[model samples]
Target: MIKLLVVDDSPLMRRLLTEIFSAAGDFEVAVARTGAEALDLLTAFAPDVVTLDIHMPGMDGLACLDQIMLIRPCPVVMVSSLTAEGADETLEAMALGAVDFIAKPRGAVSLEIDALAPELVDKVRQAASARISRATRLRERVRARTGGAMARPVPRPRAAQRISVPRGPLPADGLVLVGCSTGGPPALDALLGRLAADFPWPIVVAQHMPASFTGPLARRLDRLCALGVSEVVKATPLHPGQVYIARGDADILITRRAGLLTAIAAPSDPELYWHPSVDRLVSSAMAQVAPESLVGVLMTGMGADGARAMTELRTRGGHTIAESVDTAVVWGMPGALVAADGASVVAPLDRIAGELMALFKA
Candidate 1:
């Protein structure tokens, strides 16, 4: 059985969570109403995973997360609401080492809450298999950035010098396609931040995120990276020096027209689990462009969504890169791609930026 610690201040939430896990038949849950209580149970419970609530009385979820990571360091799935504030806090929690999260239904304990049971159970199972990133790096960075204070909000991403792409023909260098999930946000922030303002090829990213968060993530990336970032709009013409984020609620397709690529955001196939499915994106790119003119990158994520497509791209002479296990927060996605002979190169997190640059130069 997967040992789980459920940390929520609301009694109703705690009960609902326990009932949900109990019905799942594989989880042994121990509930905590506060962060302090959760810490006390850590030694006795020895949970394989934890579901933490963001709003608790004393020592709120973030503070509790910091402490838990400092001490035990296990996979933690954050329980969050669907509001903007909830999304922001959830992103911050992920940066601080939480593995994943599930949005809570509106009512505390109603029919709506019951509807979320399956999703909660599914996410908990995913969390169980997730690899927790090293928190010390993030902790130290936070300390340095905040002058050793731990109470401040996550710092806003620095604004980048925006570059306006001219209305003209696409560059001859080709296109870059990136696919990621789970721990993708920070990884992308780091990878894209390393590019120069004149990055010659158009870049498209398929990141598994909610609709509300995608816009904020794109804006944040635009502020931090040299490339101008925008959420994909249907029929929008793509250009060099710009990074397009696939719409979170839809699958985005790249189409070739007049020597330029245009992004078409349309309703995703309901059967697919991941919105903006990476496989769909890569498959579309392969259809529109010569395989040799593609560069496919598979980063940290939970599943093999893009592995097959990436392999196909590589077989057709496209350059493919996978993030190495040592640096990926979760090695499943990239590892699957690498194992399938999809990647032309495997690089660590810090080196991916340089590797991509070198590939572009070549």
Candidate 2:
């Protein structure tokens, strides 16, 4: 049976988590009331996975996470409250290497609570089954084996930046806007590594994931990309020379307030399939930046979130690019753009950044 560990300060919460996992029938559960208890438990148990609460007395979740990663490393799923502060701390845990998180319900026995049980169990199972990113683990292992500065790996060709277009030159102020899902990690890394460090415009991205995952995902991208990268905060303005990735599960829309651009995470009624909707951002950005906006590229994703926006932008005199089907993990988004006449250019991932730069020059 798979061994599972749960750490939470509340007795009721610990019991509830145990009961939920018990019904899954594939694992054994162990409980800890604090980080100290959790560490003691860990000394005696090699758990396959852990569910750690974000709030704990004496030793909070993040400190516990750092110790766990540094010592007996295992995949951890953070349990967090619904408040914004909870969201931020949950994000911190992910950046410190926690796998994923679940927001607690208002009432313990509420309908929402019951609904989350299956998802929690499944996440635990998946976390147990999956391997950590090879690149991340490789760096860690290098740091472990030798007390030396580990060199970052050399990236593949222009997978991140190559662009195709009917083109004049690219615009100088057209910062990159990237959208991806599923196989985004490695693909984005490859493409980002090829981008010029001084690419003029600030990059804005919308990737499908939960809010907690974005911060860590951005840090991972920062490690791989030459440009400065960080998770987008609510109302953070677009600035040249920095790349901002939208915090996930929110519809990322760009709005211009008195001539300045802000990345707005707005609530939506599920008109689109992907959280952090590319359509919302692209469509809204057109109005925000207007005629000055030169290019929008739709990368790998499962659905057509960006197609309508691409169409709107193309109709209004902006260039659009899509990733080629051959290299796309799931060509649905880019393919929709290609099929919809939204894309002015379609090429492999390698050429997009250069293509964008060319459009800027024109």
> lDDT per model, in order?
0.80, 0.72
Tens digits of per-residue lDDT, candidate 2, 266-362, equal: 7753767677888777877876676446467788666687788877888788878888775665577888988888787787765766666666666
TM-score result, candidate 1: 0.86
Clash counts for all predictions: 0, 23
- CA shift of 349, model 1, Å: 1.9
Model 2, C-alpha of 8: deviation from truth (Å): 22
**Among all candidates shown, the one with the greatest TM-score:** 1
Worst 10 residues of 1 by lDDT: 158-167
Tens-digit lDDT track of model 1 for 1-362: 99999999998889888988988999999999999999988898989999999999889999998888877888888988877788778777776778788888876456787787877887788778776655444653474344334543233332221112112332376789999987787778767877887888888999988777777778777876778999986677888889999988788888877777888887998988887888899999999888877888899888787899999998887778898887677788899998898887887766776766765554
Off by over 4 Å in 1: 107-109, 133-171, 257-259
